[model samples]
Target chain A: MKFHYPNGKPYVPKANSVAPQLKKYKNQVYSNRGMTLEEDLNETNSYYLERKIAIIHKKPTPVQIVNVDYPKRSAAVIKEAYFKQASTTDYNGIYKGKYIDFEAKETKFSTSFPLKNFHLHQIQHMEDILKHHGICFVILRFSKLEEVYLLEAKHLLAFWARMEEGGRKSITKEEIEELGHHIPLGLQPRIDYIKVIDYLYNLS
Target chain B: MKFHYPNGKPYVPKANSVAPQLKKYKNQVYSNRGMTLEEDLNETNSYYLERKIAIIHKKPTPVQIVNVDYPKRSAAVIKEAYFKQASTTDYNGIYKGKYIDFEAKETKFSTSFPLKNFHLHQIQHMEDILKHHGICFVILRFSKLEEVYLLEAKHLLAFWARMEEGGRKSITKEEIEELGHHIPLGLQPRIDYIKVIDYLYNLS
Candidate 1:
């Protein structure tokens, strides 16, 4: 499938498949069926919703509709539109009486996660969420390693500050692994991110 | 401007302008500049956001893109798309450590607001929100009367139940006035619904 950024530039994923040179642990089962991080999270959210565990949802992609054509009988068709940059994170909802908000991203590089994956407005949104005592975090997936981590927004903000101060432009894998909580892949809830949230917030 | 629903049916506002036939109250000021309920809410949300008083936002209109055309050196334009019926409320955010969720609607009838304005999925969404203890409600506008009220979600649920039991398909103006909190229009905030929430939830 072809993808394009809002600016019309063709978007190419860093890596779509696991690197052939990487070693695989036989004991760790890869049951994801090659699902993307977003697909896994969507499945997890659906599980949570069905079981009454949480009410989280991914916001729909924003678009700027410039023109629309309404046929005589058929549905109205958008003739012209453009993608718009999101002002907030992708996922948000209420969990255990707390507001939850986060963005998800997958990186093929095992060494670091690029800071460019996030927009500045999203960082500002996280700050606002934090000020309001909402549960704000990010779900980072190392696609090549089949590893996922839940990192608190404060840590991301700290790294973003460092980047703004002329430091490294990416969060090193070591920093993410040390500061973030690992979420084991599961069958029912795919990523089991809520478990990490439970442990972090003492909601369990 | 023309608006179409997810089903492609043309959507007509109940009343675009306040009925000039209604008696004018000399003491009251209508400072909204003839903006629709949505525009006023957007302006109010912006005001709240800028003032650091709250972090509320209107969710973008959901659209499903079917086709996109990428022209070299220009923005990718959506060629075909359809609106998606929202499965959740229109507005949601965190305010004073609480999850706020609500839908805003305007009606021309001064006697009652039709319950058909809501969908089953949205009611279910509100129920989930309530189960999670998030603050939930609806902002209703009687366009002909130029009156706005913040009605609690529980009240709406009760009215919905009554409708399901073959009761009136609408909530009477008398009932709303008695049960809902009146949101006085103001210059800075346009519709001060947050104040109503502060009073309803005792956040202030």
Candidate 2:
């Protein structure tokens, strides 16, 4: 009779029937799961983990826990805590015997990625990781274009420093096209970033 | 008037006065601010971080937040949450261009270190990391003796497999001493674990 979303939006089955435009409907159903770039990346990481391909994970959201109540022996209820800005990038782990760390953030603005998307400390942390010869990068997602790019940390650092030097507050889309590696869309692993890593590493 | 502890016990400052046994008190003060092995390691990691010697950080305790409230424009308060057993090790970081992941645990028993200190998933996580050609280990601390040792994951895996086969559930102190590297005590960076790492890596 009727198909509905959790939000109670009624679905029209006829429009999505198997026909000439089935490919369009198939693509819609494929990406039907509206996941943010971070969630999709996490799923990609899990795919990597399941096959023993990589051991990367998004660090748990940081919180400053202050008080707790032990209601039972098994459960301790936290009473007071505040979210804390992470001192480093959001995700980090081992990939092909190398340390891989990166931050994933999406921008609705298609023309340029804003500098405000990253914090100063996070940029500093990337610098620190680079000093230790670790791999660092940022995943920039332009939702309008459905494009994701792996932006090298060194390039990001250069652009970030330019902001402090009174340059542009954001990097234009054209600049990102030139400086970053585009991540191909996939089915099992939504964003296969390690392929980009191999490409970037071999280049250096 | 007499110096006293907050517990109302009078402090014996005279016994710690300059004498042949003063060195004992000095050592006590040096290591005896009463920090657990985990805290000492964290401080040591910080010392390394400050000097740009290495970048290591203890992951924050993970919590599952079920309810939160926004009473003000800028503040979000967490009302209910519970601690979750971490899926991986207690620490993971990049050191010397390599991924270092390890768990640190302390036991009061002088004879053996209990296998119960680690969860099955953590052991599996280590195996996964090792498969990726990353370094993984366990730092065992004998709190009573103030002794710490770094045990490689391969050695730990062997003992874990032995236990699954109905072998001893714990590893004896002697076995750990033989297989692991003893962390030397120091005035600064109290637990010099990187030294143990240098020793272990050179062996391989």
Candidate 3:
């Protein structure tokens, strides 16, 4: 389905074709796909910040640093560390007098998104946010197909419930297309999510 | 003047000191007397987060990366970087349906706290938050005297205005003790700033 902005400009992912090289150092793998979903969201956030539209930020993943090396006077090097489970979503902030929280993920699958992509803790966190009347959702990007969907936590919860009942473990792309709102990319704010948010808030 | 909790526990700076070896690795030139005011505030924030009292965090200072080394499948190593100016305060979060923002600073001097410790951008950020009706303040810790003060943005702005007009650029410990509320240290939450917030909210 074609997504159009009120300004008559068709939405396109900014720098979608330019793949940035991933950097790795000392047995660590970092995903570098031109511009990461995180980077795009960050750029969009900066755009919002400059216009005073909202105050949102990506939360750093909590890490338990086990070892460090002091080679010089200025820098601290983490010699050994393990990924610690994050207690909350990656992004949160305030907009229009309401609290906003979300996680962004990208998949290469064209048919459906895998349920394994999200952790149990993240799902629980979303559930808690929903209970508090805060805006919560997942920004899913099918990178291979270059499609993005803003799936509300309500829909996610339904799927999660089915999974708990030993039903289908993942929501199919067809299901997403039917249930989720397509978030079109834009120039100023690459991921124009406020419109999706407006829709969700009114629906709720 | 010594600050004591109502429970008869003395406020001690070295209660949660980071290890000296870790400090050495981090190239922390500041005194290892205890967890710096920032560390204590971070711990206090963790306490609040665990109990779901608030969701405050210190924003890492933005850094401009000049060089990075990628070796094998490991985390990317930042070879060279420069600190970029921050446009906001170090700490911000939501508390009791209101936005909370503040900066934590400590002083060794017994009588006065230096104004030079705060940057102009931070002052502007506080002003912006105040304009937006957010609760903003500074967490001032007199380490040598082992006292903490929760001074409102209005008070700091008053001092800043005087400083602009060729007045003393620092707030004396005596003045802070007179105008600011002393935050009592608690076992569960350590620096109990919520109590101070309640006082400020009631006053306003």
Candidate 4:
């Protein structure tokens, strides 16, 4: 099945030949490990939760429910609804007395991550979180290269500012490699983002 | 329009005549102020957000989408879906470099606040947050009395422990008043729960 944003953009497809589809996980490495970045993060959060290490969770996809049916004795069926763009990042929680906030995005493109993947409101949200002293970041997954990196929200804001100043609308692989912390994929927690947080924040 | 939970219990009614309905706010005091606790909190959060005082948000309602219809050149329509029980608290974020988490609930009952207003999973979530050193609590509103209280998660946990040992299923108004900080309602930042937080946590 395919899902789309209310703005008429495709959200996720069961299978996609395109570069930006979130569910483009039918590849060999992804199939061997898990599916999408979302699945990995969910697994990682569950692991963290069970071990009492951290308490992170992906916010549910926001939907604008228009109509619902109260069928007798069964579940209430949402008859008509539209996907609403999230005002904040995808994932957030508490880790070691600090608030954590982040968004996860994956691209099949091997060289660059387009700025179009994020909305303006999300950028504003990250800015607000940073001002409030929350640990804020973005998890960028290059699916084709089988590499993931944790980029602090500040770097993204810088790139956004550059874009606004008539620079390129995407952050290149080299730039990301320089500014972002590489998150090595693991078995138990899958995407060990908190490890990056620990190293960056000197928690360990 | 009326919406029901997946369990077939009424979620929100345009006008509810019975108790326990989340939308039972058609009274004079409520109409003079805001309609519901949710509206007030949302307004308060907005006030905080605008001033960069805190970075808090109410998590979106979770839904299990079973089917979608993607019409050509139009937004994808959720054809079938059901509400899912949230496994975490309703609200969480950062406050003055500390992680903050809480659930807000209002009851028509003037004598006591029902423990069943919360689920066990939410309690577990709060426990996890508190163990991680996050500031966690519950915001309770007594609609008939036009009063609000911020009960720390620790107190609620103790109450839950007593309930598990076959104690009363509800926290009496006296008990809540004794243990919880009263949140005086006002204009702009309506609930002003953060004032109670600053006082309790010595942030003031």
Best by DockQ: 4
Q: Write the per-residue lDDT of candidate 4 for residues B1-204, one digit (tens) a residue.
A: 122232345444223122332233234214433347877888898889878898889898898776677789999887877888898998988899899999999888999999888877788888888899999999999988999999999999888777766678899999999999998889978999999999999997
- Model 4: iRMSD? 12.1
lDDT of predicted model 2: 0.78
Q: Which ranges in model 3 have alpha carbons more than 4 Å from their true place?
A: A1-31, A60-86, A131-133, A154-169, A202-204, B1-29, B33-36, B59-87, B161-167, B202-204
- Per residue, candidate 1 scores C-alpha lDDT tens digits across A119-183 of 76788889889998999999999999999999999999998877765678899999999999988
* Model 1 ranges with Cα > 4 A deviation: A1-35, B1-35
Return the lDDT, model 4, position B178. Answer: 99
Q: What's model 4's TM-score?
A: 0.84
lDDT at position B59, candidate 3: 66
Worst 10 residues of 3 chain B by lDDT: B1-10
Across all candidates, the chain A TM-score values are 0.83, 0.80, 0.81, 0.83
Tens-digit per-residue lDDT, B1-204, candidate 3: 233322346544334344555566345434454346777787888787667777676765454344455668976555544444565677776666567778888888889988877766677667656765678899998897788899998888777766665678799888899989998766767798988898778732
RMSD of 2: 14.3
DockQ for candidate 1: 0.27
Q: Point to the candidate with the largest lDDT.
A: 4
Model 4 Cα shift for residue A128 (angstroms): 1.1
Q: After superposition, how far is residue A7 of candidate 4 from its true place, in Å?
A: 46
Q: Residue B137 in candidate 2 has what lDDT?
A: 95
Best by TM-score: 4
- TM-score of each model, in listed order: 0.83, 0.81, 0.72, 0.84
In order, the TM-score of chain B in each prediction is 0.82, 0.80, 0.84, 0.83
- Residue-wise C-alpha lDDT for candidate 2, range B1-204, written one tens digit per residue: 122333345444222122333334334433543236766787788778878877877777787776666686677877767787787897888888989898999888999998888877688789889998888999898888888899999999888877776678899999999998888777689887877776767732
Query: lDDT at A194 for candidate 4?
Result: 91
Residue A70 C-alpha lDDT in model 1: 69
